[model samples]
Target chain A: MSDNAAPIQLFAKKARVYPKRVWGTFRKLKWASMVVLLGIYYLAPFLRWDRGPHAPDQAILIDMPARRAYFFFIEIWPQEVYYLTGILILAAVALFFVTSLFGRVWCGYACPQTVWTDLFVWVERIVQGDRVKRMRLAEARWGFEKIWKMALTHSLWLVIGLLTGGAWVFYFNDAPTLLEQIIHFDVPWGVMSWVLALTFSTYLMAGFAREQVCMYMCPYSRFQSAMFDKDTLIIGYDEKRGEPRGKYKKGDSWDDRGHCIDCTACVQVCPTGIDIREGLQMECIACGLCVDACDGIMDKLGLPRGLIRYDTTHNQEAREAGLKERSHLMRPRTVYYTAIITLVGAVMLFGLMNRAPVELHVLYDRNPLFVKLSDGRIRNGYDVKILNKAHEDKVYSLSVKGLENVEIRVQGAGEIKADQLHVYADSVGHFRVFVVADKPADARENVDFRLEEVGGANAADYDGVFMSGKP
Target chain B: MSKNNEIDKVSGVETTGHTWDGIKELNNPAPRWWLIVFYITVIWSIGYWVVYPAWPTLSGDGERGGTQGTMGWTQYDQLKEQQAEIRARKSAYLERFENASFAEIRSDEELYAFAVAGGAAAFKDNCATCHGTGGAGSAGYPNLNDDDWLWGGDVESIHETIRVGIRSPHEETRLSEMPPFGDMLSGEEIADVADHVLALSGRAEDSEAGAQVFADNCASCHGDNGLGDSALGAPNLADAIWFYGSEKGDIMSQVRKPKHGVMPTWEARLDANTIRQLAIYVHSLGGGEE
Candidate 1:
């Protein structure tokens, strides 16, 4: 907006932000969120489960070998993949719901990118002696001191990245057992490769990429406009108090001037480095670091805080008119989002509760639909798939009925148990079963292949179709 | 600790000049590194945008979108290579086994191991649901891995089980059936002999009265010693193996209520060598009779 027939500089020299640190309610909330969220991310993988001798004991695991996922007391088999669909739906709805209540809180504190980058920036400040030393060091040529600082900082970032990647594989197996394998250099090459890839990606994204992830690469940022409304509580600057921002001369007093001293501390503390006072922006993570910085400034200036704070637009405008007041947020958008969240969560939980532990699939062989025996009887072949989803081995007995002249011949069934077959826990076992009809069955006839559990724990029945020829 | 400094800080910056817990803040400039970082990050980001598929490409040629990137790398390519490697290994083993007889393959250590691995996977894919892991053979499904053979345990017989299957329609398919003993004998008599049959397997029970019952009815199919006849498809009663079950109660129940297992022939679905490998695995199951 700068003008007067002169080309504006694409870049401008600006004052550096020296946030005189302060404390208040919003700052405390941000500190709490940082602690809780980071704590969960770095620690959740270590939780344990006790799934007996045969199963992996990680409390939350995605056991690709067993083809079952475990979470505390619940285990999901491959057949129950719909639960994953339900989870994804629920997550989307929950994101919408939260955004409706407090816009971009996830961006502000909970997002993995935000959380890690915040940590990384904190580490940078600690190691390089804050903003000044880091800038001077970058501008200066490489030296022993500069090199050591860079090396130390990068090594710390790599360690955090490694930890992040290391925790991921622990979700797929027994964490302790896998850790031992990793330590002993005996892990599968795929696991090691995945670890390396994840570590590298995490380090690059959180350490170097930082806010750019949200600004450019994230699809959520582009699509999220649909979820936001005027009632959403977003980090907004009050132009009524802060603008016509100007610096007071030596003898000026508060009565004759506007509240803002134009210090730019809010701009400096921002991880995304966008000015809140300029207005709302897509780049702002809404982290409230600005609010902390500005509130500290205001306490010193003998003026009210919240020059930059979470407020709705209507309230921001009202306050600009020197009429500050609270606004209601439980409007239509919030109600709709909350309803969807509740609905999705309920459906997901219900599906998890009713999920079955066994599945049976049958494919009737078609090549030679039926063969006529010397006895003048006909036979039909069928391939049966029996999946055992229980946590222990189970033996199932299969039977066929409805056809009067039908007799079943499983290769070893007569010598074994006539109807019973056994399978290991959390596995699918296939078998070939021939249904020989003493008389011909109708073409494209379907018969029920019923499997009844005869032994072990968690006995259950599963059914599939037996295919045959024309009557 | 320094009231004069605290008062000066509050006087200009809008502070109360009143110190809280004696920690007064200085109005010093934020570190210069932070400012430099902000600009550097913006510049570096633009550079990255040019290299990776970070932005939507101007040309809709989906190479960086739906199609492969400039690197031409793809998950499909990786998967295809892995599959090709597996196929190479399998075809070599298959080539070796193709020339060998079923028995020869069974005895060959390396060949047998390869067969077992392939056969077990095939079983899991095609047979394990009914035949327990290790081919322990579930009830109503004969344990091909066991020594007790209703038809036989020879490579040809086992192959026939995997090929034409039991009671199957192949011209030379093995087929045997015993009329329900209940039809031939009274329910009471069937129960008595079922107990005696359980006793024959060295199981403990009241066999004193069951002997007469077995001599009259079961001898016809099971034969005199209850050794059974493969020709008749009756199972042997003396060797500690049971088709329906070895338990007295299970045997009695089967006698009271007859049951049968059904298996479809695999020859029509799979190739010849896979059947050979399956037979080899089953025959090598420690219980295969000569």
Candidate 2:
């Protein structure tokens, strides 16, 4: 501690960073990914699929009011929400598998934050000029030129944000009808409010939050190192070859000095404003932009490239120890992640293929458990619900088993097989049934009720109690 | 203040020289954009105060309580506007429901839904106290969501029941009385008759004696098979549904001195539209007979 230290102030000023543009392998990759991902996001809602006249035509739709979700050829009901959980687990494991091999690669290339931020920056460069001009304009007094440029940049950002948010709402409703309703200003207030909220958040996050989201807001950044090991590929600086870093002229002494000229070119092209020479850091997105920058400088100086490159810590250590560098991709962690991913995928596929076309729920009446009729017969009432999951109308015949001398009577449909009840496609049909039988003193507590489709697709069975003697 | 400020040794960044337990506090500022957002929200809040109902006054005298802002907005006004939006959305259905007969409303799916929703709201406010939520009735109150009906289960029968009610003071109320036999018969005879009635429901071990008594006295209103008479509003005694109770003692008490239930006349209280809605809603509760 300094003896002449001044009194502590609560806040310190922030240092703003203005990153310069550069051309490299990673930059080209990022550009290609941005175009592809944004294209898919913007165009997916317009894609159409035919499902006869009974269902909407949007290829991917979540019909919330009807409690149904349609994805291309598949339709999911509320009871099948476990499929979503399965998908989330699959995605998480895939991410872990990738992260174990290549550290922070997803964060750099495919993260929504990174993609949108890149787009925002590209727009900013087009509207406000390059890094130097932007910094000058930022430091310069607010003039009319600055105001117009800033306004134009923000307006374009808002447009992109609007498109992003608009695309999201299209998934929940019939896309064409909802689009018409939105155009006519006839949509529900909730829809308009959600669109507005999502638009503002997107604009704020992509345009302004930028690096702050990666540095502080995103939980993925905090726990990312948990998936990383010494063997994982990361953006690293060859300090032994680059440092003792200093400026060099054309004919400077090459006997003792490292190849690095201390140009700070790596820092100039960095999106997160981190110094790669400071070694591997949490801020490094592993974008490899610095590698291209340093490689360009090394070419000019006639030095071998890769002073800053994608390398594993173990490889770097081995190289320093005068051993050949190697990578281990088939590690135990990666194998385990791959195995789990494959297993989960196979199980979900099987489940979807063998999904039941019909479901039944039987609830025995509780108030008066059993009614003893004048003819010495005991009658039990049940409320049965049958879900017909097929795409057309169906007729189902109801029956009961697990009891002797039982007689079944559905309220609307009679006991005979010819008196089949018609159930609408993709809907549930409710019926009140009375199961009358002799009071067998030695009968089991529960009985099975079976509903078979009349010369149709499937069957469903439900278990109900045969309450006797009392409530 | 400048005397206590210094650059941190490790990071070479300036720190607020205040140290606690040998740990110094870095003075790094919050992001500039975050500060701008904070300022924007402050301005927005001030603007909100100007337009919305925000402040409170000592008098507490306003149209909807609290200090009225410049825009003169109230929560009640917003609620009314929201309701108007919903009404606009369902205007076609509402128009049909207003003009259609009960049969027509029942036949049309859209109109039926509109009526049922309106009836549900009305039922929650007026009928749930006695009829139970979703009309899963308690003892003595009929479970509307069942195949059993005292008078009838048709749409018109339900409409009539709601309009006049059962045992109400209204002139058109469905009226019935089971004369108390407590004073007319001996305790043994009452017990025997209750057992026979239980036998009719297949609950008793023997009903020979009570069957004789039932044939002599109860068979007039209750059919010989105890199937009940809808015209007289008598319940089917052999069905699992019981209005009063299912206990043997409950049956004996009913044979001795029956407790009659009364439902208030809705026509005297609710509007015609509401009554029709209730009738449609009750009819659609999975128990309506064709």
Best model number under TM-score: 2
For B59-97, candidate 1 gives per-residue lDDT tens digits of: 777444542345555667789999999999789988998
Model 2's lDDT to the true fold? 0.82
| Candidate 2 wrong stretches, greater than 4 Å | A1-4, A7-13, A173-192, A363-385, A403-419, A428-444, A466-471, B1-290
True lDDT of residue B33, candidate 2: 100
Candidate number 1, chain A TM-score: 0.89
DockQ of candidate 2 against the true complex: 0.12
Candidate 1 local lDDT, A1-471, one digit each (tens): 212234434544543332223356656776687789867765666787788866777788898976888888778877778778888887888888788778888888789898788777777777887665777877789999999998998999999888788878888777888889988989888787878898899899888778778888998877777787777888888776676678866567766556788887887677776788878888877778888888888887767888888888878767667786777767888788778878888887777776666777777655334443323455565667788777788888777766667677554321334366777876787766666665534555546666777753333443434333443
Q: Where does candidate 1 stray beyond 4 Å?
A: A1-31, A185-187, A249-251, A320-324, A412-414, A455-471, B1-290
Using DockQ as the measure, the top candidate is 2
> TM-scores, in order shown?
0.62, 0.76
In terms of docking quality, model 2 is: incorrect
In candidate 2 the C-alpha lDDT for residue A257 amounts to 80
